[model samples]
Target: MLGIKNWINLNSSSVFFKGTRIATDAYGKDLLVSLYRKYINGYPKFFKMDPLSRLGFVACELLFNSEKVETLQTDNLNEDSCLILFNKSASLANDKIYNETIDNENYFPSPSVFVYTLPNIVTGEIAIKNKIYGETSFYVIDELDATTIFNVVSSSMSDTNNNRCICGWLECSNEDNFNAILLMIDKTSDTLFNIENLRNILNYK
Candidate 1:
């Protein structure tokens, strides 16, 4: 059975790992950027990514940078792992920004803004950062459903090529209203992957 070995959750005001709060924001600063600066010092391109991409990037970084994830790496190769992400907004926040660029004559459409109009870009950003040349997919659901998520991940893992997966939900509605819950799943743990577990993890704090 697939099991979650590690997980990270980032919301508008806090960051949590394994059900423990790691950081909280009281002044309402951009928590993503703040976490980037405090925990991650490198990756200059981080500043250029949209809110969704930044959220996913930071969560992935936090998950994979740990010693537990390091031990799972095989010579810097992560091709056996797949990324499955779902969201309700599906880049709508960035779409609004991109719309404004072309909707008015004063400002031309920005290529940088246009590039992140797709929800899958966040998955791409994670893939690029980790050098993971594996299957990646993003789904836009009407709401958060654990059964749907489990089914999708299960279907993807049916292929023998996919040994592990990074799966979760990421949503960025506005600059300050965002949340990401990324989980590293494989068949090496005692905790089984099920709808109940997924719900419990996602709802934890």
Candidate 2:
């Protein structure tokens, strides 16, 4: 049975649910594509996603589908919630790729590549897939600050309209270096989704 953990981490080619290493591949790209095909098939648009979006998408899949017992979610339930994501690298990795295409000699600007230049694209993708209709926000900071994350979560929860959230960090500086940590937190939640609590529960090494 799949274990339940507070956090999901995708580093390189390995995937951990609540720190338990359950899946691995030869490379990070292989891992993302494999997971997508396995659980999120028929979504051909997935191929157009940048590294960061792919990283977040896969991590959300693991966290949302990991445990048998239900927690926070959407779709058939049609819950209204916000998806707040934080990252330092933003879309620099994909931006670099898009830059190459716009070079003087290359000059091959692809709409698919251009669309992913926005850092918030990952949030949009997840919101669409998960049926999140509330505010979807993405912040770029110098680093991941648990205090800041908590503050944002608290602020979001303070709104009666937004009673729940899927918040965390998704960073991908390159195709090989990527990480995603997502939490499904509700205003009246039992388990606190703080970074420390999640870190303690995470079994990924």
Candidate 3:
């Protein structure tokens, strides 16, 4: 069975891990910045990431550093771990930002905004931060389809023979609406990792 060792979800409301809400008063972007300052003050590059990348980066930090996972050393060293993320908006938020920079009236394209137009860039950010050498891919679908996500993740894990995988739904449609469901999964026959659980987490408050 593919069991979930640790999981986290964050939205405009709050953040949760292991079914317990993390103690915090901050919300939205402020919440992310707070988490970074509390746990990742040394990573200066995190300040320069796009909104989506920043969201995913913080989620990874919270998920991996938790006590549920003991393979931290091998988790970073092995090449079998994979990252598979699903998003409803494929960098549309950043695309709109970049488009504004080159509008008919402005006619100026900022390269900085242009760099984050790819949805996979968030996955790249996570992989780079964790040194994951295995497959890392991002899918843009109409919504958080649990069946599709389960199929892709199971297939990828099998193909890579990965003992551990970072799979979840991550999306930032805009400033007002953003969501992240990050999970650390391992192939152990303890906790369940099925479609129903995926849907529950994706729809969690």
Query: Per-candidate RMSD vs. true structure?
Result: 1.7, 3.9, 1.8
**Cα lDDT of model 2 by residue, 1-205, tens digit:** 1111356777776777655687555577787888887766877777878899888888777777775325345354435567788889999999999999999988999998999999999989988877777889999889877777767766766776766666777889998787777776664546665546644433236
Residues forming the 10-long window of minimal summed lDDT in candidate 1? 22-31
Cα displacement (angstroms), candidate 3, residue 17, comes to 0.3
The residue pairs found clashing in candidate 1 are none
Best by lDDT: 1
User: What's the lDDT of the predicted structure labeled candidate 3?
Assistant: 0.82
lDDT (Cα, tens digit) per residue for candidate 3, span 1-205: 7887778987766889977998876878788888899877788988888888888898888898775344644554547788899999989888988888988988998777799999999888888877788778899889888899988888777774576788999899875468989888888746688888777877777
Candidate with more favorable, higher lDDT: 2 or 3: 3
Please, what are the lDDT tens digits per residue for candidate 1 over residues 39-155? Answer: 787899999998889888988888887535764465545888889999999999899999998865667988999999999998999888777888999999999888899899987
Ranking by lDDT: 1, 3, 2
How many clashing pairs per prediction, in order?
0, 2, 0
The TM-scores of all predictions, comma-separated, are 0.94, 0.85, 0.92
lDDT of 3 at 56: 89
